[model samples]
Target: MNQYSTHDTSGAQLKLWDSAGPFETGAMQQLRNVASLPFVFRHVAGMPDVHWGKGATVGSVIATKAAIVPAAVGVDIGCGMMAVRTSLTADQLPDSLSAIRAEIERAVPKGMESSQTANHVKGGWAITPNSVGRAWNDRFEARWRAILARHPKVDGKTSDQLGSMGGGNHFIEVCLDEEDRLWVMLHSGSRGTGNRIGTYFIDAAKEAIAKERLDFHLADKDLAFLSEGSQLFDDYIEAMHFAQDYAVANRELMMGRVLEALRKHLPAFKTDKQAINCHHNYATRERHFGEQVWVTRKGAVSARAGELGIIPGSMGTGSFIVEGLGNEQSFCSCSHGAGRVMSRGEAKRRITLEQHAEAMKGIEARVDEGVLDESPAAYKDIGAVMDAQQDLVVIRHRLRQIINIKG
Candidate 1:
């Protein structure tokens, strides 16, 4: 028996793992638009967390033959989660976590646009640390320059954004697992550089559609795609990969800094070197069914059997560490998070600041109106989302954040 329900449109069948929740109309339409794309290999899969996004629906897995959709990969290339389980337990935590949170915030610069001043250098680092500089120079500099040589428009500000957390859903948290072990978790991406590459290619795709004599016509311009074997396709693939690798290094650098900072307050402990670091909003070629196709997981995780991944909830809610089941029909993918039920604007307009504070009662997090959009109420029921994709993964650890830092 099939594990998924079909949300059939005209072209490719869209399989939905929405057992616990129904599809919203806007999200359904976005899926339909992707399904109708001619190059879609076999099927499109939607996770329980599926929601309307700028190009494609979040939580979608699109496998296409000889084509790639830049918008589907999204602007924040390689955006995902990283988690490290530590030897220390929750009982070791200080009574006042405020100081620890402050240290972490200081260690990792966050939020939008840094003034580059001494007092408050938010967003990018005020001064690029030697470690970050080495990592960039060793791993990224040459490839970045190569990409810029071809598509300089894709170039944007500050490699200092490396190892720093950016604003929005991006955050850093100190969590305690069910067994009460301390864990460090964070969510971020390739930052501004990745956004620039994605935005440039998304437009390039649309231009290819308009300029080239392609037989296909897109109902939605965002659905525009670059055909395989073209110069634009090759360039995008190269640049996109650079962004993805940069993002991984970005997370690694931040994790090291966060761990180093934590040592000041807590007893020294070693981390599980194989910390869970995986990307959600990225694409790669993989074999599905019998076809080797480009599978783009916009808001999904590659859940190949035995692979561990992190699925986090909203602030003050529960999160899970999971092992993939490698369910083939869904392309061995799972939902990235609880997924937003409301847009940031809608959440702020509707969810009261008082309610937000009440919901975050036991947790140390920003309950101000500025972070109101990220309140727990703004997201889908995480438990329900987990239940919906039971076949996709097995839960390893259930974690609750005691200290949370938002960008």
Candidate 2:
């Protein structure tokens, strides 16, 4: 752990878990900015994967008293990871995994734009499945209607995107643990709806600050916030909770579809019944240091003692299933992944197609220029990241992906 004192009158400090490696100067500046906020409680805790983000540094845990920063949660309201252990073993899988990958892609819509034909949408469901429809109608329909009544700008395309995968770092994979046990893992979140809600609230926060002429001046305009007891604050809390629920349901729907697709090609397999579903990007009220505050984990996961979390590496690298130790100093949080070491644009310009293919040599995934930005070389070494946060979590299972499907 490393500490940096801003020497500001706010009396807040910056605590970082990157002693095993170095982080960008921009990320350190963001941390300092957050720590300097008057409402920030105690200090700002940064995970080993900390990196520069729009508002706060990614992999940061911010606990604030009577205030909330909408942009700190980012545009992906409930983005996270989910993993399920299956009964299938390595020997059960066929020598080739191309067929399985193809099936998964066919079952779930991926990439920026859903493929479409004259008659119907190709990537998404041409006809909504009964299960998905039932889930939406029973669980989300009413809440969505209520939200739309207030904010019509929220995307109405929720139904079609329920089980579809979005592009950019979101992925589904088939992996094997040390025991050769098979597990299916995926990364995604509330799709367009979450984006719309987050954008609306962020802008609303800025407007509220400006309209009231609040005495707050943020280091980054995106850090504009909503104070407690305000009507906009209540509205944002409601909408944010709804988006989070949608994200959980979205992952569940996709998991079911992926399992069904796998069944079509492989022998019958049963899941362990309990899957770890967690959100690394989101905010919730919690009692920290004997005070009720909003804990916003941006690119960080709740690591309350005995809790299960997933920390994935870039494609072609190993991932881990971890158990949290509930370290209080960190506000019980851990890194989301081997955080990006390079910007997407820099990665594209510096990494070559040949290098990407070589890095992902054995994995069955996209080997083209489209996926070059997410290559393993673009991120920090997972081993170093894990080493840096030994106090936060304990590894339970290490997984190596054999098949990776990137959106």
Which candidate should be chosen as best, given lDDT against the real structure? 1
Poorest 10 consecutive residues by lDDT, candidate 2: 1-10
TM-scores, all candidates, are: 0.97, 0.95
* C-alpha lDDT of candidate 1 relative to the true structure: 0.90
lDDT of 2 by residue, 1-407 (tens): 32322243434496778835456889878888888778999889988888899888999999999889999998899999999999999999898999999888877876555555311263346678888899899999998888888878775567877777788999999999999999999999988878889999999998887777646667788888999999889889999998898889888988998999999999999999899999999999988888888999999999999999999999989799999988878888899999998999999999999999899988989999998889999999999899888889999999999999998
Off by over 4 Å in 2: 1-12, 116-123
Could you tell me the lDDT of residue 81 within candidate 2?
93
Clash number for candidate 2: 0
Which residue segments of model 1 deviate by more than 4 Å? Answer: 7-12, 113-122
lDDT of 1 at 366: 87
Return the TM-score for candidate 1, rounded to 2 decimals.
0.97
User: Global lDDT of each model?
Assistant: 0.90, 0.87
